[model samples]
Target: MRLVNTFAAAALATGLASAAFAQDPTKVGFIYVGPVGDFGWTYEHDQGRLAVIEEFGDAVETTFVESVPEGADAERVLRQMAQSGHDLIFTTSFGYMNQTMNVAKQFPDVKFEHATGYQRADNVSTYSARFYEGRHVIGLIAGGMTESNIVGYIGSFPIPEVIRGINSAYLAAKSVNPDVQFKVVWSNTWFDPALEADAAKTLIEQGADVLMQHTDSTAPMTIAEEEGIIAFGQASDQSSFGPNAQMTAIMDDWAPYYVSRVQAVMDGTWESTDTWGGIDSGMVAFADFSDKIPADLAEQAKAAADAIAAGELHPFTGPINKQDGSPWLAEGETADDGTLLGMNFYVEGIEGVIPN
Candidate 1:
């Protein structure tokens, strides 16, 4: 009987240790520049956070602060999360770059991942999707479908990332239809619905038949639907908001990246790495083409997407010119990552001042 009691006590101790281990969950935090319900960038990022939750059921705990401003307030929120013992934090906005860097300096132990930022630190990693690839595909569709030969693009900021997308879209459109004209309007805000809607209306009023946006709001799509024009969804699929108006969406799939990063942290292999994934890496995806697009043009768009994913074609191939008509690339040459990463000016044929 004494021997049996000893075995029971030993088993109880082992169980207790296992229970303690199970109680310690990895705490992860996410900071959003816009509300999760914006149905654009933040919503898609929240979907990735949800993917993390689903990937590691009880092994991880997650929290988020949404609609946080991208200034000092971002730093404060990040500091709070770090102080709260968040093991990993993802800041999902370009404007949060300095704030993320500042917070990372304060907490060297916490890991940070900032989206669309060039800055990096020992504890902070930067990541972004090659959204330009998707832009190229949609541009082909726009070029083929536009009756007015005018395409309007709503820009969020004059940053390189947004500029790259505009240039890519315009280049692709011009390739297919040299007569295509681009009109660009800057909204300056990423998530203001009223401002985005006003921009859309203004562009349409200015004789734009096709509308595209780099901003993170469905207001443009909503306006497109009301005005019976074609538009593309940005960051996330906004088809539900504009079934007829939405030509296709450029989806940012953060699930795979987020899950892998979190797994690295759990396995003690997390490091400061810059990841720029695109259509080939499954980071940039295209939603289904709307029926408004002709079948032949849709096929061409899909083929172009396939070519990009397979690396058989590059969007920034030579014979391209800068905004001032200067030779940017020679024939049979391609633009390297260095130049693409800091693309500040428009390619030839795009007329506008990149607001400082």
Candidate 2:
């Protein structure tokens, strides 16, 4: 049910993909917050792990622990990986940030990569895709297609990443359909199917005809399919779960980065850095557009996505305002990375307070 775009495979064909095999297999470890079968965020990440194997073959031995809870459990798993001689470790969850750092301090030799976190250290790197870019495109489609103008957004958290997505998607929807309103319900957890399904039904009851989710499950998509409403897939393609409902999906192509980072460790050229790649870099790829989408609207969505890839369109361009209606960005000015990375407040027009 998951199709990694050809773009992702092409990106995975890195400089090291064809490199000569080294003597010892590089010991790479992965920590996941959800099961690989979730068919969403964790599924895509595990796919990246598989890509590392496909590209390097026996030159690298990759191991992963799935459904590992974030916090003491994550730290314990990480310490065990480090102690077991894992040269490189990827902690693939936002909640694993502090734990990754703490464990990195203990194992100075292990290279650590933390996803969707801002903090970095001498041996730790922070990397995340511009997921909001795809959100904006889907928002455009959702805006043009929704008959009720109510788009239900299931948010996993109120952090900058989630808040930024909510704003970007809303802004794009509002731009296309002025009456389009986002009804956001935070499930708070990243991969709870029951909770996600309940949130989707609640949104439908509140008059949402289109469902969008940031959580990592197909439950919402299943609900949308049964409700005969359209929705977008998260993290990976969930088209199988809702063939008619999924308009398109945003795929987080992590294979390329994983390969290159592992190659770095092998070559002893690894250095701590922060990487934020978007559509242009293939880090943010998309699934096939549904035939149900109008050709004209599909063209518009592609054009907008192309603009984002070309860096010509920033999703958060101003004349935007704070939720309080205070001016945040001047006309024609775009938001910088710092403000976007630390984004805390909701934009104007979104209702309800962000959960603490």
On residues 227-272, what C-alpha lDDT tens digit does candidate 1 reach at each position? 9999999989899999999999999999999999999999999999
User: Residue 321 lDDT in model 1?
Assistant: 88
lDDT of 2 by residue, 1-356 (tens): 12122232232345343344446578788899998899999988989999999988878777788888887988888897787667899999999999999999998989999999999999999999999899999999999999999999999988999999999999999998999989999998998899999999999999999999999999999999999999999999999999999999999999999989998999999999999999999999999999999999999999999999999999999999999999999999999999989999999988888998
Clash count for each candidate, listed in order shown: 0, 0
Off by over 4 Å in 1: 1-23
Q: Which runs in model 2 stand beyond 4 Å of their true positions? A: 1-22
Superposition TM-score, candidate 1 onto the true structure: 0.94
User: C-alpha displacement of 159 in model 1, angstroms?
Assistant: 0.4
